[model samples]
Target chain A: MDLSLIIMQLFSGIALAAVLVITALGLTIVFGMLGVVNFAHGALFMIGAYAGLYLASLTGSFWWGLLLAPVLVGAFGMLIEFVLVRRLYGRSIDDPLLLTFGLSYILVEGVRIVFGSDGIPFPTPPQLIGVVDLGVGFFPKYRLFVIALVAVVLLVLWLMLERTRVGLIVRAGARDPQIMRVLGVDIGKVWLAIFGLGVGLAALGGVLAGPMRSVNPEMGTLVLAEAFVVTVIGGLGSIVGAVVAGLMVGICISMVALFAPEMATIVMFALMAAVLLVRPQGLFGLKGRA
Target chain B: MPVYETKSRPAGLSRRKAMMAMSAGVAALAMPRLGRAADDTIRIGFPTPLTGPFAAEARDQVKCAELAVKLVNDKGGIGGRKVELLVRDDKLNAGEAATRTLELIEKDKVHAVVGALSSAVQLAVNEVTRARGVIYVSISQSDTINEVKDFSKFTFHEALNPHMTTAAVARQTLKKGMKVAHLVADYAYGHEMLRGFKRAQASIGAESVGEILHPFGAADYSTFMPRLMSMRPDVLCISNFGRDQANAIKQAVDFGIKQQMKIVVPVILHNQRLAVGADVFEGVVGGANYYWGLETQNKTAAEFNKAFRTANGGAIPTDYGAYGYSGVGSLLQAMQVAGGTDTEKVVAALEGLQYDLTKGPQHYRKCDHQSVQSVLVLESKKKSAMANENDLFAIVANDPGADEMLRSCSELGHAT
Candidate 1:
């Protein structure tokens, strides 16, 4: 293989990883903080893409869609948490799982009914339509934008979690909700905000991804599986773990695809299995978290 | 709220008389109506993926089939017996396709079966329909289905096989010593298309630089892009269907591969072209079973297009959707020619039956029951050239059902 080709492939892998990181981050936070397995996370991601596409068409600007899609979808997520997910908090673990699984079907079907089952094209913004000539090879400008955006999101997320009072309470609540309540914090409200934030991240990922992939009702089905794999391989709730595992899975898939293309999809599952065998709680998960 | 006395009955009848009438109506509605003898209607089972990656295409197929049914009934429907279409969703899985096909045969008692969109799903449907001696007109492209092992007297292929379409496409596109590479979907359809392309390449003296097989419904093709770029082939042959095709082409353009080489798809879908828009698809060459632009050249195609548009809010019939129209139209035409819906009579009537319901004249080859029809070589129109949103392709070339383009009988393991 040519050295330049290898360099390009590695960069492509990182571009893929950027998408996985953002999507998986949502799943990890919701699972970690709320202890609810959000099977509808993929549906939320799909809804975000549709919402963005609809808004972009309505507003006549891709930027408006980008700015408003996550906010709108986040508000929707907050409503879901309040009206439906809140009722399942004290119930069996399977309750939320089953509820979200059914919710996924309803949401996907709802989109199908409204938008039709066909994939709708979302064009890359005019500013990002062309390629950027990297030293090794040319890459799509939109993809480069996505990678930079994800890096910025990670930095902002880190700063907010480590420095802000809300972040402190969120972190403390994830560790021990009862103690936070005893300390005069409204843990219920905190959970609602966290769920909103998590799904908002998913929506952001969707908005970014629409131009790259086909935007359809079932678009989230495969991504949901891939996101779950990333979340599992990363520790259940560890944010940094998601970043590392996302990149690892992405690179593994890309390299395997180069040599043995048939094994690309399977390689990620193999990585997850290998990781679980060594540390069942995931790469960065605390002991007993699983 | 006002309430009536419990014992009072309506002026029309007494309570006992009403109860008796209602019971009789319930019994009549509940009675199981089985077989063509119960009601003088010909039931044809139409199964396609309704909820998977191919849902949009499948829905279009259903629409086309419905149009065919309506056209037949409008014309008095095969000797005054109405036609009934029993539709089912195969869900794009082989197992589910088999199960749905069985139900269509046993429960619905359809005289014939039609419409499985995916190559693998069609085979599963063929297995069930062929065993029961039900006439099955498959509208999916696949080479293996035409082989002696899979072909049956009752099996009729209304869609062009991979060999025919690829040969038509390759002959039109390939040049001597040109380098070609393939990105194939890892399934029956993809493998057969690659084989067909390779055969065509060998005949044209083109060099096969590289080939990579990716899983079906693969969302990302970036991982394979680097290696493909490294190959530096003159043409990149993408052998996938549905969203996979759209994504691969979109990403190939994204990676600047389009600037280096031509991209050729074995099968290009109308709905997919519309969804992805004309910009990404521009200049891409491929073969199609039907193109609405053929309306200009063929009277039958013009009529079909007008009827389809009238029924579907002015949307043109898709390539795969045309298969549904042709498949059901041909089957019903055969029944009319035979003067009845008997399996043997219909089979005999369908063999070598020539008709031009859509896309000009076509006939089912007697040797393998494969539809001998024109293959359209289409080029995606530039955004500026498109007259309307649906004017996505310009017909570059037309292979008008030349016998030489199809595989010989012996080659398909059929006795000459």
Candidate 2:
């Protein structure tokens, strides 16, 4: 491959990594701290896209949609946590997994019933519609925006987790929920907030992805599978791991797809399998805490 | 893959005879309600994807089917029996499609079945409807459905198959000695499309540069875009559908592949144009089974378009909805000629059938039961040139169902 081709593919891989990282962040955080599988993560992501699309349509601005979709979806996520997921927090992992799986189906079908099955056009803003020449070759301006936006999100998330009191509590909860509970921090409320945060992050990713993809009902399915792969390969509950793994998976798939397009989807699973064979707890997973 | 199983294809067309015997016995036992006398209503079962990836197209199909039923019933019904539509959500699942086909044939006792959107779903339904000797009018585009090995006496495909569509597209667009690279979806439909293009290219003298079989629903095509751009082919033939097509188009534009090569979409869907933007599709030549813009040119198309728009709250219908309308209309025409819902008589009546619908004249090719109609070759105008909401494609060529546009029965593996 030529130098320009390599540069373009690497850039594309970075754009893909942006989506994968944002998408997996929510699932990883929820699974890491609450031990809830959050199978509805994908559905939440789809709902976010729809929400953003509708908001963009109503306001006639992609900016407003970006500003509001996450908050709206996050609030909705909290509602779901309060109503459905709250009861099964301390229960067997199977119960939450099964419940969220059902939720995922319900959300997908519900969207289909209401909005119909066709994908609505989510256009990139005119300002971001063209290409950006990067000394060597042209790249999509929208993809560059996606990369920047994801970086800001990751940075904000890092600061929130590392610099804030709530972030410390969350890290503590992930390490030992019983200790946090014993310390009189209403664990239930913390779980609810964390769930909402995770769901909101997924929605944010969905909104970001909307312009780059066809926002249909099943749009979430592909991303959901990829997020799961990212989570597993990165380490189940590690944010740092999700970020690292997301980039790795993205670059690997991008490089492979360049040579073997047929193996792009399968390669992620293969990567996950290889990672598991080498490190059962994932690259950043705690010992005995799959 | 069990979800895609049909009785005639239990082990992928092997053990066909044994499975047919088993299916027939089961159908005989389950179809106790088949003895219902010619009732006050004629039921047509429509199994479509109401909750899957193709749900949007399926909804349009269901609407078109309902409109057809309304038109027939409004005309005092076929032989004074009101047409009742038994619509079921196939969910685009092959297993579910089989079950629904059986349910419609047995319990609901639909006089005939119509409306399967997906190739896989239709293939699965074909096995059951064929075994039960029930008439199945398919709107899917699978060439295999009409093949002699896969054919059933009772099945009729109303939409253009991959070969037909690609042949029309290639003839309209490809010039001699043009370099072509195919970014085909890695699936049966995509393979069929590539085969059709290669077949057409053979006659036209177009040179094949390279081909990439990308996974369907791939999240990104950045890698493929640069590699494809590197080949520097004259034309990039995209043989994918739905979001994959849209995603590829968006990314291709992002990667500046559009500036390097001409992008040719064999099957340009309405939703795709909107998703990828009209600007991206500008000046690109392609073909589709139908487009609502035809209403301005053809009287029948005009009437259907007006009625559909009114019914759908100003939303114009696309070629997909055209399939649903024509499929049901053709089935009803056969029933009218047969003068009853008797399966054998209806089948015989439809053997050499011709009908005029949205397009001028269309007919079922007697050999493979594939619908032969004019494929509309269109060029997407610039965004600024779009006159109205549905004014997207500028019809450049209305290639009729000539000998070259359609493959021979032997070529389609349906030799008598």
Task: Give the candidate number with the greatest lDDT.
Answer: 1
Candidate 2, superposed: residue stretches over 4 Å from native: A181-189, B1-40, B310-315, B413-416
**lDDT tens digits, residue span B148-210, model 1:** 999999989999988988988998889999999999999888999999999999998999999
Candidate 1 lDDT at A260 equals 92
Candidate number with greatest TM-score: 1
Q: How many clashing pairs per prediction, in order? A: 0, 2
List all candidate RMSDs to the true structure: 3.9, 8.0
Residue pair clashes in candidate 2: A118-B56, B3-B95
lDDT, model 2, position B154: 90
- Scoring the B chain of model 1 against the true B chain gives a TM-score of 0.92
TM-score of chain B of 2: 0.89
lDDT of 1 by residue, A5-105 (tens): 88888988999999899999999999999999999999999999999998999999999999899999999999999999999997888999999999999
Point out where model 1 deviates above 4 Å.
B1-32, B35-37
DockQ of the two-chain complex in candidate 1: 0.76
Candidate 1 chain A lowest-lDDT run of ten: A1-10
lDDT of each: 0.90, 0.85
